[model samples]
Target chain A: YREFYQCDVDVIGSKSQVNELELVQIVDKVFGLLDVNVLVKINNRKVLTGFAEICGFPDKVVDITVAIDKLDKIGLESVEEEMREKGLTDGAIAVIEQILKLSGSTSEKLASMRSLMNGGSASGLVSETGLKGLDELEELFGLIDAAGVKCPVEIDLSLARGLNYYTGAIFEVKAVDFQIGSICGGGRYDNLTGIFGLPDMSGVGISFGADRIYDVLKGLDKFPKSLASSTTLLFACMGAEELRYVLPVAAALRSEGVSVEVYPEPSKLKKQFDYAEKKSIPFLSINGGNEAEAGTIQLKNLTTGEQKSFSKADISGMKAFMNM
Target chain B: YREFYQCDVDVIGSKSQVNELELVQIVDKVFGLLDVNVLVKINNRKVLTGFAEICGFPDKVVDITVAIDKLDKIGLESVEEEMREKGLTDGAIAVIEQILKLSGSTSEKLASMRSLMNGGSASGLVSETGLKGLDELEELFGLIDAAGVKCPVEIDLSLARGLNYYTGAIFEVKAVDFQIGSICGGGRYDNLTGIFGLPDMSGVGISFGADRIYDVLKGLDKFPKSLASSTTLLFACMGAEELRYVLPVAAALRSEGVSVEVYPEPSKLKKQFDYAEKKSIPFLSINGGNEAEAGTIQLKNLTTGEQKSFSKADISGMKAFMNM
Candidate 1:
């Protein structure tokens, strides 16, 4: 089973263009640091509603939009059949298809959409919401372009998020190099808290699918080397007497912000050293039964196999020697 | 309906004096920064086992430990009855009472225990595991004393953490000023991951109850003004088109590391201004219908009630004015 971890940032009582742009900026900063190229496509459910109105299926907007949104996966033919089953007419289906196919540069796309949907006829008036949506979409793009964001911001007309709450700009972020689906997504919801009796408030936020990002980074070999950073020293002891001699020395070094570990129990020297070797621990402090009586300790550099004995009385010298 | 958050740090795969003392130093740093006086009580489960074995309820270690651990909630008589039900003898009960009464400096207490348990055929060599535990506890305190950690550690013989996994040093941290229970607790478990088929490995860890800390700070009014830091500026808009003009400017300032919020929608000026006031938002950027065409914006400092108009071309000037 695959696990998912949610990394969400939310703003309460906000549903403005500035909020939308700031969210985009945050997304850019985080993923840019992760060195992942992305495509951020946006849509407005209101525009889909206008498309529904022009198709004479105003009341079935949810059904029509839901089916059309699955066109990428289930195919256009299957969506059309689903629409037919939902009581949408041939005109409605054609309008939906035309809107889904709408594409061009920011301004060109808006111009093409306006001309196709606005015929100066009654049905054209029915698509008034669609025309207004184009105006809002233009404003969103103008903000993105002026902000000089490097990532592409496409006007994906068929990108209808299935949630019924989104009222304005809706967003989905897709990784450019990975075959996975959208790794980050969110949008504006005008009256979510209204269900909790806090009406008319709007919010916009985004959630990063942390588990997916972890997988993608692992697959790309992008995780930083410091992820596995651990203790620099492992104190080795063969029995109870040795453990007593090294205890104070280990404690003194640890107080100075050093990462240190002590092997518990009086195990065999080889077994303990092998355990330290497997963890890639670089230094070993060994206090044998003889050393305990002598009040001395030995430091071994695991990497170079160097060993040196030090007087336990000169704790300061040991600190300097260990570079703690 | 209270809320809480946990902050967890673990020492996995080792249980050395160095690992244990380093954990103490980290805990000291955390609590020192938060500036709260705490009492850290230290104990060992192996000692608890010896106490149980000497109490003639060796097979009922779990039940006996669980009962006595609740001594703070229930009285001593209740614990005695629970021990008796587990088939404890009068000699065992007397030893249990003596253990309960044990206290002093770490070394002094251990020496007293040694004399009581080991001298003159008192309790059959004091159980080898119990003697081993005393040695471990002595080393632990030697490390603490050598480090000069500021927090006080109490050697509580009755402090048995009831978890099934812990094998060595158990710890509990409590704030001296608060009336709540231990806000942090953990211990060494020698074979936790072993249950997942990785045996003989040991780990030590502690978890800080962030929610409880938050409550404690809230009770003491210790959270500084900077804790709830939010954006300094809120761009207020008159209509959808006007919001388009201010979005990019907000984005640019935010990119420069200034926290910013865009007022959602172009509602009435009064409503937007009041919303800003409620959130204690400091500055208001008003780029309404007229300002949009002129390519200028109004900046209002809510704190000083000072308002000024500036050209959009003077974005650097606006940033300077807002102290970005």
Candidate 2:
């Protein structure tokens, strides 16, 4: 439900190297943070349009592309069957099957596409639109190489993204180690806002499927340990009077950027200690009549079971002791 | 859209001092951060129920409460009119008006409610349920005082929250200086999930109206300046070769927790610097043929307009220079 409209020409140009590198860098940083292997598959919608022209069904481009997008889930035969059901001729289906079977290094696939668009084997189907698509792909690959993106990428010719609004390059990211579908995707759209009466503004952006990414991370057990808890210290008082005495200390610690909580009412010692344990709080500050009257606080390292007493005035020292 | 099931009795108990203190502490911290004056109004649905019983129309409690919730928006006369239309007696409406007009300091209002419930002047309306509700309110106020909650509070008997599900304490937070509706509110719901077949579970929670809070902050110009841009550095290279050379440097900076971007296709110096300016990137690193051959980088501070050269190995120093 979130949308970004970028009208900056340098970054939103359909085939700009600046846009490509920025995207690759983002992919690199995201995967680097997740510590997950990913493959960034890229293709151009123009190429698909040219492909439909060469299939002799330029008018049925949307129908063909929609069916082709389900190839991954339904298999090639099912896609071919669906296209045929959509009124595509046997010749068009065969041409699509040949394109789907394309596999090799990115450059090798680009070369194959170039030959196909040059009318080397397919005559009367190659068009200037098809050639232009190949040229854009070649330039994109060159910039990707110059940018030195670490993630593996391929010129996935069969990747026909479902949306019909994309007018140029399309990008999709897949987790290499997980079976979840594309975790991120977006593409260039020339004049997407034109339909809203603001014409000639082009833009491109990517959206991470956050829920699916969460699922992937959870399934892989890749979440970082630091996200476990927000509370770091608990004040375990012994009585109502002790609680009142500890309130200012808790407030001071909180102001010093330490997450601190005071047990509201004095309960059983075991129950208070168990509360600290269950919350995984690393430090516990306890104060009773004796400590309160002495103007001091008893600090206990919950993890180490070490206890010490500090003067209440030594707030800075207590913060350092608790590593706040 | 978020649902939390709290089965722990200690934290979820509606009358528990621990739970009340925790909520008050949280409210204090949040309002402290927002730096806005707020009034935290508290009432118990049980108290409203008692009010209905005292009005001699226990069965019409829901109808009366719903109408009372719109008191602020439609004034007292309209509320009385609506109640009359809903079949309340003229005597009952007059009594309700007396209750609604009872307003003063929180303690003074609580005293007035006690006398009213004790049948001082309006006799034979007080019930055991009403007494119990008053006792709970007294205990909650005592706990709030001990917890040292900083926000102002009021005991307005007319404050009937709209929801019928709240069985105990209801809280509504309002910004004193802003015209927006409640910025946050929540209440205790007893056995809400019992309809789904699980019984005897109680929970209480508060939800901050984040969108309204954001609007308030924007209108007040209270957002921190650091939120303007996430990127701190931009590497402006001279060519594809320079981009390749700067890629690792950018990666290293990113690994060190600095947000950095490199000019993708090495355009004019002016264009790259313009990109940096537009993005609000504070630092720009330029390494052309001379600096590249010397294994050095020219860093420009966009904010201070200070330019200096640093050895390529001084990445740690560069990070320190940018205060990242």
lDDT of 2 by residue, A195-310 (tens): 88878877777777777778789888898755665678889868767776787777777777888877756788898899888878788888889998999988999988888899
Task: Give me the runs in candidate 1 sitting further than 4 Å from their true place.
Answer: A1-15, A49-104, A120-126, A163-167, A186-207, A228-324, B1-19, B45-104, B120-130, B161-168, B186-211, B230-246, B267-277, B280-324
**CAPRI quality band, candidate 2:** incorrect
Winning model by DockQ: 1
Give the C-alpha miss distance for residue B43 in model 2, angstroms: 2.3
Clashing pairs in 1: none
Clash totals, every prediction = 0, 0
Candidate 2: Cα lDDT at B103: 80
Off by over 4 Å in 2: A1-230, A234-251, A260-302, A309-323, B1-17, B55-104, B124-127, B236-238, B245-249, B266-324
Residue A25 of candidate 2: its Cα lDDT?
68
Cα lDDT, model 1, residue B158: 57
lDDT of 1 by residue, A1-324 (tens): 176787887777855566777777788878778888888988887777777777777788788878877888899889999999998877767777776676767788778777765863234545778778777787777777766676877877667665576877888888888877888888888888888999988888788888888877887777865465487788886765666667677766666666777786678889988988888777898887788788888888887887888887676666676665
